[model samples]
Target: MPSTPHRWITTPLTAGLVRGALDLEPTAQGILPHRLPAWARDQNTDGQLAMAESQPSGVRLVFRTRATAVELDTLPTKRIYVGAPPRPQGHYDLIVDGRPAGRAIATGGNTVTIDLGTGALEHGTGPVATLRFAGLSDEDKTVEIWLPHNETTELVALRTDAPVRPADASGRRTWLHHGSSISHGSDAASPTTTWPALAAARGGVELVNLGLAGSALLDPFVARTIRDTPADLISVKIGINLVNADLMRLRAFAPAVHGFLDTIREGHPTAPLLVVSPILCPIHEDTPGPTAFDFSRLGDGRLLFTAAGDPADGAEGRLTLNVIRDELERVVARRAANDPNLHHLDGRDLYGEADHRELPLPDRLHPDAATHRRMGERFAAHAFASEGGPFAEAEG
Candidate 1:
């Protein structure tokens, strides 16, 4: 065992800025991050909702330290889908002085096993584990520990070889983004690698992500949350979750969008608000969904989702990606004529047919890590570039 340093400082976890999480509450074990606040979470009792809200998709611990070594204690609940391949271990992405430093995985927490055959869940709790990083430069620098995007983690403690302080704001524009699983980092490599996070880094902006997996159903509560939050730039990525859940028809989706935007506008009446439609998801482009898990591939240790709705259902108002894109374009165009602060970006521009050929979405529903990187880079160029961009004039 390595000898312990003679002196160390323990900082309260709350001392570090935690972005992207809507709520933080004390748990029996530690402080748990919630993408949705307790009141919002209380409105839904579904297991999927519970799991998704607790995952802390874009939450990160950011502080300034001169420590040569640091340690974080966390109790993570790792989920296991029975009959499928084991998930990769949850990881914390470490960023030092605005650059990727390394990654660390905490071991021995809790395991949640789900049986597909019976729809039963078995949870086993374990002890908290430490993730230690050593050999740092020992110079005062900003340190960001991006929480695991997939696992439900409860932060236990933060310890360092030297004192730490909250990091100073970089005076960059704050980008507040809301969307579905793709934005929530579905299959991205790590929390910092998620498309939104990547775009933030590329654009030199601070990010407050409101992407919620299996939960971006254009809910009014979410809209109000975004409206209330402080942001210099705002974006709402819509469509996929509604289609996959078969939540509503076109008649409802359009009005729901209007209402959602209305709520956001109530708080951010003049902030540059960008409306983004769904990307080119071939399976859901023309076909409506009620996406289903492809069990045939599950036997091969792969979990894939396929659209189950009929293409002919369009006449019945079934929502599809194409329909969503058209509606979003119309909505943004109609409103933009009167509201110069509002803008629209075709999701296809971010991940379209051309990009799909080179870097495909591995699960057919979410972009892989590499695809995420591409999308981020493209979004930065299109939205944050100096000339002919919506944000160009606003920067000054």
Candidate 2:
């Protein structure tokens, strides 16, 4: 008798297997997941937000199968900064049965070259890359393939030695989070290790990360998106992007924050809604932003940022970390009096001045991998692990 040939089954990458995205766009080559729905995407025109939402930070392909071998074809948008050393390749993290199993990277895909100094751009395309994982346990198990947190990826195809189906529901609460680059896994070791991801795992909750890089500017559309989304627990990390982008003055910031929270309350009237202020960033602690790249570091191929706005500008309502924090606390306090579920978490508690002394932010903006871990652990303790904490009831 002839030996049986190895068998492989290919499946369409549909919304059934994708999580953490609000919409799925069909492409000729594959499916592109977007954190923002088509309607919200249409309401926005900012290229930065569009790019950030396109990156599937906390999104993952989750399914149940006994396949000992699996492969994923992806077209990733890789970035190359002119005159700078290439950044490390983004990682795809694998988890089995709620635990980390393995990791891999897709090699070829699209590349975008950007010149920071002149603001020039160029693009190139490469063959879709296939990432594979072998020697998995043959036992029926839930498999989760986490997309790269920092790269925009399109799912081209999935192949496994055995057929796959939707994973059994874990019966975990869904945690919806929105924040800036730090929460977007800017310098995280991998997709699954981002602070929000880690916190969700430890809290035993499903995560929907809307950490839209530099785009968390308290947009009404974003607030509307959050309002429409369904979640057991919701958190919005504000302040960092507002300061760093110098998007609005204090007068405008307060109403924006209020309106954002009000919109969410409209849809989730009784959900445990947590408002988080910006973490301790010494560079912008007191100084107003419009953060500018410290191009001086470019000589050594290092990227760093510095505050561009004058400190004295605060008298004119220029927003800073401290200013934002005070306003957020006030807003939550007033609302919590009548709305019992409303809560606030100072981002400093997650990554504060003490943390900065030991593990300074390498880029002066985003936390590094270790800080990510620390923030995640601290956040879990305060939000989910602590007695009578915001999400503790759900956790219990």
Candidate 3:
């Protein structure tokens, strides 16, 4: 009897098969899920959760099974579309059955092509024959490919081996993160260097980055996106964007957050989701957010606020960090009795009083790389540490 080809090896963009034929299931678009490539797992590397960086080594694919004999087949000419950042520069490694197969490098946009060898059956009687790749650095990275498994085999598991320590699959765990431009990492450094990435590294769980720069509008879509993704933990950092963008009124803010969490419950059911409010922003701490500035002028003194109304004025719909924090606590308290998994973390807890006093955000918006590192460490200790309250059981 011949060994069976249990699973198909393809990029996330391409459809996967659960049993037999190609299953075209519609995944939630706009919202990005942290996915690991097959090759990442083969190499025993814990790939980044949400975003990936381009590396000189490409990703690989590995197959695990109980069959005695196995065969190897390569697609003639296939395109691997990568959801990478603009002007990506790196190489990709391709591996098969723990052997180096080939390499692919980023060209114009974010697509790489690899010509697999002849589609012939190779004899293999091992429990697992992993296809792996190397060559991704800490930059923006995303790739998709098409590798169809033989219809005769059984598909067991799929994963990516990233640089971080592999997470335990035993108990359920969830990680939630929130932030401003720095959290979103507008331009400071590479993709993997973002606070969310660092934090996820420390936590050892999947992440849903809700750090929308110039856009964390508390929009239904943002909340809906969070509500939709499955998770064991959750957090939301709100403030900077609201203040800088000057998008909401105080009256609407509290209810909006409630609605956001409420929506998330629809999908997550009973997962531990932490609600993180904004940190201390002096400019917006006492003043109402939604402040405006002219993009046309800056150094010339042409910059000016469009409105004189104070966000502190309770009469108006203006917002402030302090006010948002209070409301968040109230919202959680109101809903806590009904939902045991619901929790809240003050952003200040990660980078509060002392840290802010020492290092303020550059340009009054984003944190520097050091701050990102600190934030990651603090988050891990508070949210994911086993000895801690919320994530204690999860850590086990």
When 1 and 2 are scored with TM-score, the better candidate is 2
Of 2 and 3, the candidate ahead on TM-score is: 2
TM-score of 1: 0.96
The clash count of every prediction, one per candidate, is: 0, 0, 45
Check candidate 1 and list the clashing pairs. none
Error of 2 at 119 (Å): 2.5
- Per TM-score, the best of the predicted structures is 2
Question: What lDDT does candidate 1 reach at residue 172?
Answer: 76
Ten residues in a row with the worst lDDT in model 3?
A: 145-154
Any idea what lDDT model 1 has? 0.87
Q: All models: lDDT?
A: 0.87, 0.91, 0.48
Candidate 3 lands at a TM-score of: 0.57
lDDT by residue (1-396, candidate 3, tens digit) is 112223323223222211111122232221112122233223433222112211201112233322222232221111232221132222233323223344443222222232222222223222322333334333323322112110012122333332112112344254655455556554334434456655664665544454544555565655556665556666777666666666687777777887877887887878777777776666677676555543344444332333324754745767677777888888888899999887788888877779888987644545666887787777778877666546656422
Candidates arranged by TM-score, highest first: 2, 1, 3
Greater lDDT among 1 and 3 belongs to 1
Q: What TM-score would each prediction reach against the true structure?
A: 0.96, 0.97, 0.57
